[model samples]
Target chain A: AQTVTQSQPEMSVQEAETVTLSCTYDTSESDYYLFWYKQPPSRQMILVIRQEAYKQQNATENRFSVNFQKAAKSFSLKISDSQLGDAAMYFCAYRSRGNDMRFGAGTRLTVKP
Target chain B: DAMVIQNPRYQVTQFGKPVTLSCSQTLNHNVMYWYQQKSSQAPKLLFHYYDKDFNNEADTPDNFQSRRPNTSFCFLDIRSPGLGDAAMYLCATRAGPQETQYFGPGTRLLVL
Candidate 1:
């Protein structure tokens, strides 16, 4: 079974600064996808960014990006220019082709003004 | 807006009582999923429906059941609620097997 692990339980970043949340996974499948999801206090889950295992270039979406290292089974999320709205519980998820998705325990991100 | 919607944002049920959570989607996606998330935990897959085909996770308890009457609606029925069953239930929908899933705001379930 594939599993995702987020080592940090909680993280804090100053306004306009950057923060990186670490994530690692255990998967034998060569073809898979990694995703970062944000769940705010409202309890609504929102997609942050995604990275395909076959892609060497890291995926970037505005201030959110991922450092996906397939060999190391590491997929970290980086939030640049962090804002108050970024405060939420961030989850790292994994999904193999034609399979169910799994998520990490989650990292609570706090943005400080 | 083509989004997933869950009814009764919050619910309180007594122990041994049965409860049902409803989910509807405007996206008209082919797949709908139900996930249970305990406090301070990740969401766990309960079951999913691909059109009319029901798929339950291997470890899901038999006490949990689901119904998808049509393309737009799905329901999660817990036969007997327990304190341990109290959690946030989330609903998600996707266009295809490997498509990105859009999640609903979730319903907070409290078993007393």
Candidate 2:
């Protein structure tokens, strides 16, 4: 079974600064996908970014990016120019082709102004 | 906008009572998923429907059941509610096996 781990339970960053949330996973499948999802107080889960294992280049979307190291089984999310709206519960997820997705415990991100 | 919709943003049910949560999608996707999320925890998959084919997780409790009568609507049924069953129930949809899923706001279930 594939499992995702987010070591940090909570994280805080000053406004306009950058924050990185660490994630690791255990998967034997050679091909898979990694994703970061944000759940705000409204409880709406939003996709942040995604990285394919076969892609060497990291995926970047607006201010959100991922540092994906397939060999190390690490996929970290980086939020640049953090804003108050970024405060939410961030989850790291793993999914293989034609399989159910696995999610981490999640990290609560607090952006302080 | 094409999106997933879950009815009753909040629900309060008594112990031993049965409850049903409904999910509808405007996206007309081929897949729909139900997840249970407790406080400070990750959302756990309860089951999913690929069109009319139901797929339940191995660890999912027998108390939980799902029904997908058609392509656009799915329902989650808890035969008997327990305090432990209280959590946020989320619905999501995907176009295909490897497509990005769009999530609903979720229905918060409170068992008393």
Candidate 3:
């Protein structure tokens, strides 16, 4: 079975500061994809960034970026200059060559003014 | 414009009543997936349709069923909705298994 884990259940960061959310997955397959999705209060989920397993370079989407270490099966998301809008539930997901997409226990990010 | 759409954003159904949620996509994606998300939890995959083919998750409840009559439309039917079935049902579409998924505003199901 494929599983994704988010170690931090909740994280807090002050405005203009930076915070990182940790994620790791267990997969035997060599080719797959990783994604970070954000779900704001009462809103639909949106993609933040995506990282392919074969790429050695990490993925970045503006202020949102990921430090992906495939050898260790670690994919952590970093939010630089955290904004109030960034406060939401961040979910780390894994998708294999198969169609099934699995999500981790999401990390709730709180931004302080 | 949002490519994916789910109708009746909020639905209330009585216990033991059968309910169906509809999803349509204009993206012409080959794979459409239905996910169930409870309060403060991850979205769980119920089933997905790859074009005309239907794929079910091994642990998906037997009561949950899906249909894809055409390339752009999909439906999820709950044979007998229980209290545990109350959750936000999300519809997503992607070109294929290897593509990024685009999601629609989910339908929140309420079981009474």
lDDT of each: 0.93, 0.93, 0.94
Task: Return the interface RMSD of model 3.
Answer: 0.9
Tell me each candidate's i-RMS in Å.
1.0, 0.9, 0.9
lDDT of 1 at A77: 95
Q: What docking tier does model 1 reach?
A: high
Cα lDDT tens digits for candidate 3, A1-107: 78999999999999999999999999998999999999997788999999999999999999999999998999999999999999999999999986578899999
lDDT of 2 by residue, B1-112 (tens): 6388899899999999999999999888999999999988899999998888889999999999999988889999999999999999999998986688789989999999
Model 2 whole-model lDDT (C-alpha atoms)? 0.93
TM-score of each: 0.96, 0.97, 0.97
Least accurate 10 contiguous residues by lDDT in model 3 chain B: B96-105
Q: After superposing candidate 2 on the true structure, give the runs of residues whose Cα lies further than 4 Å from its correct spot.
A: none
lDDT: worst 10-residue window of model 1 chain B: B93-102
Per-residue lDDT of candidate 1, residues A1-113 (tens digit)? 89999999999999999999999999999988899999998669999998889899999999999898889999999999999999999999999987889999999999999
Instruction: For candidate 2, give the lDDT of residue B94.
Output: 86
Query: Model 3, range B39-73, lDDT digits (tens) per residue?
Result: 88999988888888898988999999999999899
